[model samples]
Structures are given as structure tokens and as C-alpha cells.
Target: MNTVKINWPNKKSSNCSPGVDWLKAAYDADIEIPTGCLGGSCGACEIEVNGEVVRACIATVPDKKELNVEFFSDPYW
Candidate 1:
């Protein structure tokens, strides 16, 4: 399986499979990414991945050279 390096906002990094669940991978790396709905219906689980805003609940890790991910916070979530 192919793997990609994910860099978190906390300055922590982890090597994960491209098909892995983003939320689970983040959690395994000791990073807590807040979530609301597990599905893609709600926008509360949105996150920034490689400069793109993606819904974590419905998005999977991608195969990339490296992934820089940051949590997307909404004042009114």
C-alpha cells in the first residue's frame, strides 16, 4: 500500500495510507480534529488539506508527496 506524510497543525506528523480515514489517522497521531456529523451532511468536520478545504467525515487521505493539514474552525459551528 502507498503511504503519505500528513503534517498536523500541532506540528506532529504521521505516515498513513492514502485510503485511510482522515479522522482516524489524525486521532492515531494524537491530534484531535473536532467533528459534528460523521457523514458529509454537516460542515462541522471540515478541515484544510494541502490548502484545500475538505469535509473530514467524508474525505479520505490522499496519495500525495506530503499533506499539510489544519483544522478548520467556525465561530458559529
Candidate 2:
């Protein structure tokens, strides 16, 4: 199976297959990505993937060979 490299903000990285659960991948990398609702309604689990904001709860790793992920912080959250 093909895999992609996810580069977290902490300089840590992990390899995962395409379409894998992003939250699980983040957890495997020891990266804490807060989530309020796992149903993608609360928007608390928002994150930036390849410079685009996506809800980690409902999103999966893309087919890209490398993904740069960063936490999307919201003061209101």
C-alpha cells in the first residue's frame, strides 16, 4: 500500500496510508489536536493540511506524498 508522510508542527512526522483517519494519525504522532465534536459540527478539530483548513474529525489523509499539518487555533474555541 502507498503511504504519505505527515509533518506535524512539533517537527515530528508519521507515515500513513491514503484516506486513513487523520485524527488517529495525529495521535500516533503524539500530536494533540483538540476536538469538541467528532461529528464535524463543532469545528473544534479544525486543522491545516497543506495550507488548507479541514475538519480532522471528518477528514482523512489525502493521496499526497507529503502533508504538512498544523493546528488551527481559534480563540473562541
Top candidate on lDDT is 2
What is each predicted model's overall lDDT from 0 to 1?
0.86, 0.90
- Model 1 has an lDDT value of 0.86
lDDT of 2 by residue, 1-77 (tens): 88999999999889999998889998888888888879999998899998899999999999998999888877885
Those runs of model 2 whose alpha carbons end farther than 4 Å from true positions after fitting are 75-77
Per-residue alpha-carbon lDDT of model 1 for 1-77, expressed as tens digits?
A: 78799989989888988888888898889888777888888887889997799998888998887999988876885
Q: Pairing residues by index, what is the TM-score of model 2?
A: 0.91
TM-score of each: 0.88, 0.91
Count of residue pairs whose backbone atoms collide, per candidate = 0, 0
> Which stretches of candidate 1 lie above 4 Å from their native place?
75-77
